[model samples]
Target: MEHSMFCYQCEQAMGGKGCTKYGVCGKSPEISNLQDLIIYQLKGIACYAKPLLEKGEHIDKEIVKFVENALFTTLTNVNFDLDFHLEMLKESQQVKETLRNKAPHGNYPEAATYNLSATKEEMIRDAVIAGVMYEVDLDPDIRSLRSTVLYGLKGISAYGHQARYIGHHSDQVDQFYFIALEAINNNNLTLEELIQMAMRAGDMSVEVMSVLDEANTTRYENPSPQKVNVNIKKGPFIIVSGHDLRDLELLLQQTEGKGINIYTHGEMLPAHGYPGLRKYKHLIGNFGSAWQNQQQEFDGIPGCILMTTNCLMKPRDTYKDRLYVTNVVGWDGIKKIELKEDNTKDFTEIIDKAIELGGFEKNEKEKEILVGFGHHETLSHADTIIKAVKDGKIRHFFVIGGCDGAKPGRNYFTEFAEKVPDDCVILTLACGKYRFNKLEFGTVAGLPRLLDIGQCNDAYSAVRIATALADAFETDVNSLPLTIVLSWYEQKAVADLLALLSLGIKGMYLGPTLPAFISPNVLQYLVDTFDIKPISTADDDLRNSLQQAN
Candidate 1:
C-alpha cells in the first residue's frame, strides 16, 4: 500500500496503521507533514535549549510559550489550515535557528542541522523526510518506545499550555519538555532506557497536571458541586466550548447585561463549579455534552460558537459561520479571536454575534445537568463515601474518564455506565463523561452517583481522591475497590493514562479502542507490567471488575 503521510498518534488511525492518506480527525496530508516538520523543529529547539536549561542559563519565557503553542497546534482537530501550519513551521524554524546559533558549540542532531527552506514547495519537500517514522529503527520495540515518548510529550505540552495560559509556569516542566524531546532523538538509548524515560515523562505529566490544577483553582476557584443547566434559555446566547475557563470568564464578563446568556459546552461543563465564573447570572449553564455531540447538539442553535482548544470537528455549515476560534484552535475560514496586550481577550465580537443571532425564543425543555464533583467537593463527602463502601451500600468505584471520540465502539462506555450497579459510584471527567452524563445515576449516600471532576487536566484531582481513599483505608490505591475504565481519543488521554500508570495504579480497562501508536510489543509490556486490559464487552468487564473488587 502507498501512503502520503504517517500519523498514528490518535485512537482512530486507519486500520491500526498510521494515517496514510489523511487523518481521521480531518487533517490532510499537507497538514500532517507540516505537523511533523513542526515537531522536528521543536526537537531541534530542545536540543539547544536543554543544554542552557541544564547549565542554569535563563531561556526566554516566550520560547516556552512558543513550544506550548506549537505542540498544541498539532492536537487532534485543532489546526487544519495548510498555510497556518506552514507559518508555525516557519516560526518554529526561526526560533530553532536562533537557539541553535546561541549554542553553536553544542553537538546538535540532524534535526538541528537541517536548514528550513523559505518556499512552500521546498518546505513540503523537507517535511516528507522529517516525519517521525522516517528512519524506522530495525527493532519494533525501540520504535514503539520512541513513539510512546513522543506521544507523551504531546500530552505534556498540552497540559503545560493550559498551565501557562493561566499565569502559571514551571521551570521544571519546561526543562523536561526540552530534555524529553532531545532524548527522543538519541540513538544510543536502550529499550529499557527509553521505557524508563517514557515513565519519567508520565511522572512529569503528573506534576504538570498538579501545577495546572493549582493554576486553575487559584485563577478561578476550587471546583465544587454545582448543578449545571443543560437546557438553553429563551434569550440570545453564546455557547463557549473547549476547556479554556479564562476565555469563558472573559466571555461572561463581556456579555454581562448585554441580554445575551453564556452557556458552557463539552469540557466547559465544569465551569459552573467555579464561584468566580458562576457569579454572573447571565453565565447561564451548560448547553451540550461533549465535543463529539456538537453537530447534533449545536444544530440550529441560535447563538455563536467559540472554540478555545481541541475536539473541533469540521464545523457543519449549519453553524460554521457563527463558530469563532481562539488561541491554538484554527480552521481555515473561521474567524480568529486574538488576545489583547494584557493577556485578556475582548470577547466583544462574540457577544455582539450572540445578540445578533438572538437565541431560542424559549427553552424547549427544562433540564438540569449536574457537574462539578471535583476533588474537594467529592472528598468533602469522603466520610459518607467511605461509610457507604464499608456498609456495603456502595460496592465499588469506577474512574471512567478520558477523551471522547465519534466511533461506534464508543457506545460501550454509555452501555457500561448505564449497567453499572446502583451501589457503585462513577467518577468521570473530560469529554468521555458525555457518553453517560445525561443518564440518571441517582444518588448514593446523599451524593450524586456520578461525579464530574473537571477537564482532562483535572486527572490530578482523581489521583488525589483515590490516594486519599487508599490512605483512609490504610491500603494502597490498587488494594482499594477502584477500577479505572478509560476511554481515549487523543494525546491528553495518553498523558493521563501514563500518569495513572506511573503512580502505580494498576488494572485499568482502556477503550473504545487502544491507541494506534502502541505497538504490539509495547502493548504486551503494558499488559504484563500494569495489567492494563483492552476493554471487552461492557457486561463482561463490569462482571469481572465487580468480582475482582469483592
Candidate 2:
C-alpha cells in the first residue's frame, strides 16, 4: 500500500492537490494519515461533548484542551513530527477514557467505535474502509461544506489556543467549538441543517474573535498608527512569524537589550501597533510579505525565523538551519521551543542562537510601511470617517484583503487594487496587502485612502468600521456604499468570512479559488444567503462589485 502524501490543509499545498508521498511542508504520508485519523477521532470527541453541553453539563477544561490541541495539530506547518501526533493520540485517548467513565451511557454515537491509539497503517486502512463500507455516507457537498466549517473552526481554535496560553479563557467559545465539531461529524445532518450549522459557526466565530480581541487589546493596549521598518537592523535578530502575540511579547522581552533585534514577519506585522509591544525599540518592522514569500524573503537572511503558528511552507535549504518552531507550528529537524504545560515558551535557546548568527554587520537604512488601522484605532476616527463619507470625498470603500498564497491567481488582487478608481478608498490588511501596498494610492480628506487594518485577525477592524459607518448613517451595513473584495488562502480567511456573514454583511466577493474543502451544497447555501461569489477577472470583479454599490 504505497500511499500519497498530498494534503489540502493550506492553499499552497502542492498545487491545491493532496500531497501523496511527503507533504510539501515535510509532513510524511504516515504523519498526514495519522493527522487525518486524529481529526476523525477529534470529531468523535466533539460529538460526545455536544450532548453534554446541551444537557447543561459543565464541559471540562480537559475536553476543551483536546478540541484546541487537535485543531492546532491539523494546521498547516504544525505537528509534522509523528511522535507529537502519537503523544496527542495518547492524551486524547486518556481524555476519552475519562469522559466515557464519567458518562457511561452518554450519547457518543461516533465515539462508540473510535480507537485513539490506532497505528498510521490502521488509520489509513480505516479511512479507505469507511469510504467503502459505511452504509450512510454524507453527500459530497455536505462533507465539503462541513469540512470548510471544520477547517475554519480549526483556525479559530489556533487563535483561541494562543489566547489561552496568555491566560485567557471563554466558556462560550469552548462550547461552540464542541458544537461545531459535532455538527461536522454528524451523519444524521441534512443539507439545510448543515447550512444552519455553518452560519452558527460563523456567528460563534464573532464571539471567538471578540474574545481574542479583548485578550489582545487588554494585554497589549489598543493598536495605534505606527510606521514599521522593513530593513533588517545590524546585529543578531529573530524574525517572528504567525499570529501569536503572547509569544511575540515574550521573545521581545527575552531579547531586549540582549544585542539582538526582533522583527515581525507575515501576520506578526500588526504587533508593531500594540502599545505594549511597540514600546520595544528593538522590535523592528515587518520582514516579508505574506507567508508564501518566505522562501525568497528568508533566503540568506542572517537570523532565525520563529514561527508561532501556521502559514509555514516547506523550509528551503539555505535557511532551514535557522528556522525555529514554537507553539503548534512544527517541522522535522527544526528546533522546537516547547511550551510548558501552562503555555509559556522558554526562549533562552532561541536567543542564544540569534547571537550566534551575528546578523548583518551594518545598520540598514529605514524602510517603512504604515499599519495599525484596527477597530479601536478606526473607531477613534469614526467622527471624521463618517463626515468624509457624507461629504462625498470618499466615494467608495473597498476592503481588498486577506491571507496571501503562492498561486498565480493571487496576483489578481494586486491588479485589482492597482486598478481601483482613483476616487475609491482601499482598506487592506494581512499578507494580502503585499499585492498592492507598494502602490501609492494617495489620501482622501487628509487620511491615506489605502488603509492597512493590521492582520487577518484584525478583520474585526473592517467589521467595526462598517458597523460604525452604518450606525452613523442610520442604515444597514450592506446598504452602505462599501464593497468587500476578499482573497483567501487559509483557514483564518474562512473564519473572517463567517464573521462577515454573522453580521449579515452580504454580497462578498471571495476568491483566489473556492476552498477544495467546501461542498457544493454548503457553497450553494452561502451563495443563496450571503451572496458570496468567487473572484473573477480583476477588471470585471471590480466593476461588478462597484456596480452593486451603485
Candidate 3:
C-alpha cells in the first residue's frame, strides 16, 4: 500500500511524471528503495556533522566521504546493484551512529535517533516513511521548491565526489552539504524562504565546482590545443570512458610499451589536451562516439571497456564480459576494477584481457578530431578573440553544453551547433559535445569556431572564461553577448544549471526536456523569475539567441 518507489528527479521519468514502479533507467524497486534509505541515513549524518562544522570542530573525513558517495550513488544510471547500496547504507548508518555518540552533547534530530533496518523487508517499510516523497507539504509550491533543492544537492554531491578524489576539499562546500540537507527537512518555511534556499544551493554549486576545477588542473596541468585521432588504430587497446582523469592516468602509465594502446571514450576524450596525460604516447585516439551509442558501438568491441564514473548504460551482452567499472560505478554482474587504500589500482588483469581480445585491424583511412580548448588555451589568444568581438567579426558566443542522452529531441543540440553562424563561437563541454564535436568548424580570425572546454567538471572553467571576457569588455556577464543553450540528461547538469542561476544569468534555454521533478508552479516560477525556457526547434532557438545577442 505504501508508495511503490516514486522518483521524479530526472528528465526521463515515465510519462513526465514519477516513476512509481521502476526507474526508466532500468533501476528496480529494490534498488530505488535502497537508494532512498541511503538518503535517509545521509540526512542523519548531516544532522550531526552540520553543527560540528558550524562550531569550527572537525567532522571526521570518513563521514564526509560516506555522505558524498551515498548521494552520488543515487544519480541516474550510476549504480544498479541493490546489494552495493545496502552495504553502503549499512556503513553510512554506522558512521552516523559513531558521530552522534561522539558529538558534544546537544539535542539530536529524529533522523539522528533513527536506526537502520537489519533486513531488506524492514528497510523497505522504513523507506516509505523516510524517503523524500514522504515530505509532501500542504503547499504544492513549497514541496516543488524543496524537491528542486534536493535534486540540486544530489548534483553538487556528485561533483564533490570527483573533487575529493583529486585531493580538493573546501570547508564552505562541505558545510553547505549538511546545511542544504537540513533545510530540505524543515517543512514550516514559507514559499519565499524555499525559493531563497534553492538559490543558496545554487551558490554552493559554484564553490563545489571550483574545487573540482582546481583539483583537476593542479594535478593534470591546464588543457591546451591538441589533435585527437577519431579513427581506431590497429592492435590490442583499452577504451577508457567516463570523467576520471586519474584513472585514465593510471591506465596510461601502466600500459606503456605493452603493445596495447589506450583510447579515450566519451568525456575522457578531452584528456588528450592535458600536457601530463598527452605525454603518454600509448594513450591513443578516442574510440566510438557518445555515451548513448555505446550499446551498439561497444557491441563486440575487440578491446577492454573501463567506465570510471556516471553515464554508464546497461552494457549489452555482447561486450558485458569484457567491460570493467571502477570509482563508484557498479552494475549487477560486471567486474569492478578495485583500488587499494592508498589510491593505487591494478589494471593488469584488464590489460591482459585487452591483449586476449586483439583489437581492430589497421584502417588506412585514419580520421582526426580537435579538442583541449579549455580556459587557458582559449584565453591564450585572448587578444585576438577580444579584437574579433570589437571588430564585429565574432557576433555572439553560445555556451551549448551538458550531458548527452538517447532522448528523441537531443538532435536539437547537433543541429543547433551546426547551424550557428560563422560569425559566432560555440563553447562546449561534457558528452554533449559528441553531438557535433566531430564536425569541422574552421577558424574565425585565427581561432577555431568551436572550443572544447574540458569535461563536465570544467564547467568552472567556462564560468571563468565568461567572467574574464566580461571584465575585458567592462560589462557584467549577463550583459555580455553570450547565450546559454544547455542539453541536460543527468544530475550534474542540474547542479551546473543552478550555478548559472545563482550568478543571476538570465534567459537561458534548457532541454531536451525539463526535469520531471519541477512541478507546474515551480516551473512557472522559474519562467517568471529567470526567463528559463524549454527548448523549441533548433532553427527558432538559434535565431532567437542571435537576435537577443544583437
Candidate 4:
C-alpha cells in the first residue's frame, strides 16, 4: 500500500482497524499525519514541563495555553486541517523553546524528549523509519490500555484547559500529566508499572476536577435545578456545542439582544442551570443528544452551530456552511472565531450568520428537558435525600453515565437503567443519559429517581454527592452504599477515572468495551487497586453492581 491516505482514532474506526486509505469520517492522510505530529509535540512539551515542576519552577499561563491547545487539537472530531496542525506545531515549538530558555538548567525529563516539533512529513517519515506502525505494532492489550490513557488524558486536558481559562489551575494535574506522559513513553516500564501509573493518573484527575468545580461554582455560581426549553423561536439563532462555559458566556454576552436566539447542543445542555447563564432568555433550549448523534440531529436544523469545544463530527455539506468553530476545533472552509491574547473569542461573525440564516419556521413546541443536578443543586435537596435514605425510601444509588459511542453494546445502559431496582436512584450526566433520560423513573421521597447532573464535566457532581453522602454517614467514600457503573468513549473519561481513583472511590464497573488503550498489566493494576470491572450483560452487571453496593 502506497502509504494509507486516511486514519481512524475513534471507537468506530473502519474495519475494526484504523482507516489509513481514507478516514471513514472523511479525514485525509495528510491530516492524520499532521495530527500525529501534533500529539508527538504535545508529548514533547509535557516531557519538558515535568522537570520544571520538580525544580520548583512555576508554570506560566502561556505554557498552560500551549498544552491545552495541543491536546484539544488531537481530540476526536476536532481539528482536521493540516495547515492548522502545522501552525499549532509551530506554536508548540515556540512555547517549548521559550520554556527551555527560561529553564536552561531545568530538569528536561525524558518524557519531554518525544520530539513532537517535527513537521508532519518529517514525523510520518520518522514513524515509518522507526517501524512502529499503528496500534497493531504494540501488544494488543497494551495498545488498548495506552490508547485509553491517551484519550483519557485528552479529556482531562480539555477540562483542565477550560478550568485554567477561568483562572483555575492545579499543580498536581500538570505534574500528573507530565509523569503519565513520561511513563507512557517509557519502553522499559513493566505492565505493572504502567497500570499503577494509570491509576495515579486517575488520582491526579481528582484534584483537576476539584479545581474545575471550584472555578466553575465560584465564577458562575453553583448549578440549580432548572427546566430548559427545546422550542426554537422565530428569528436568527446560534447553537453552541461542547463543554466550555466560559466560551458560552462570551457568546451569550456578544449575542445579547442581537435578535439572535442561542441553543445549547450535546454536552452544552447543562449550561442552562448556572445562575450566570440561565438569566439569558435568548440562550434557548438543547438542540440534540450526545456528540455522536449530531449528523442526524443537526440535519436541516435551522441556524448556525457555534462549536466551542470537541466532540465535533465531520459536517455535512448542507449544514457545513453553517458550522463555526472556536478554540482548537477547525476544518477546511469552516469559519473559526479566533481567541484574542486574553483568551477572548470574537463571535461577531457567528451572530451575524445566525441573523442571515434566520431560524426555524416559527416558535416550535416546547421540549422541556430536565437538567441542573450538579453538586450545589443536589446538595440543596440534601435534607430530603437524607430523609429518603433514612426512611428506606431510597435504598441504592447508581451512577450510570459516561461518554456515548456508536457501539451496539451501548444500549445496555438503557437496559440497565430500566432494570435498576425501584428503590434505586440513577444519577446521570454527559451524553450517556440520552440512553434513558426519556424514561420516567418516577420519584424517591420527592426527588426524581433519574437525576440529570449536567454534562460529562459535571461528573464532578457525582463525586461531590458521593463525598457528601459519605460525610453524612460518617464513612469513607468507598464504604458508602453507592455504585459507579460508568461507560467511557473518550479522554475525559480517563481523567474522570483518575479523579475517582485519587479520591479512593473503588469497585467501579466500567464497560461497553474496555478501553483498547489499556495494557493487561495496567488493567490488572486497576482491577487490584480500584477493583474496576468491565460491564458484562446488563442483568449481570446490574446484579454485580448492586451486590457490591450492598
Which one wins on TM-score?
1
As a TM-score, model 4 comes out at 0.90
lDDT string, candidate 3, 1-550, tens digits: 4437888877788887778888888788778878887877777787787777778888777777777778888898889876788789789888987878766687766777789989978888888776656766557777688778878888888888888887888877777778877777665678888889889888989999888877878998888889988988889999999888889999988999999989999988999999989999988799888888889999998889999888788889999989999978899999998879898799998999999998888854778878898888888888898999999999999988898888688899999999999998999998999989889899888888999997886777788899999999999998889988988878888888889999888899999988877878889988998999999999998898888777
> Tens-digit lDDT track for model 2 on 160-183?
887787778788878888788778
List candidate 4 stretches off by more than 4 Å: 5-10, 13-26, 46-49, 99-120, 127-148, 187-192, 547-550
Sort by TM-score, best first: what order?
Answer: 1, 3, 2, 4
Q: Assess every candidate by TM-score.
A: 0.97, 0.94, 0.96, 0.90
Cα lDDT of model 4 by residue, 1-550, tens digit: 2455434346556664556676655566667666666666666666666677778887786677677668778777777876787788778777767666665464454435445535556656644322225434676655555565676677778888889889888877776666666566656676657666666767666667778888888988888888887656777788899888999999999998788888898888888888989898888787767788888877866789988887878888879988998878888888888879877878878777788877877777787767888988898888888888888888889999988887688898899999998998899988888888767788878888888887787788898898898889888888877888888876787777777876777888887777544556767877987888888888897787768666
Model 4, position 463: C-alpha lDDT score: 89
Assess the local accuracy of residue 171 in candidate 1 as a C-alpha lDDT between 0 and 100. 83
The CA-based lDDT of model 1 is what?
A: 0.85
Pairs with steric clashes in candidate 3: none
Q: Which stretches of candidate 3 lie over 4 Å from their true place?
A: 1-3, 104-109, 136-138
Off by over 4 Å in 1: 1-3, 104-106
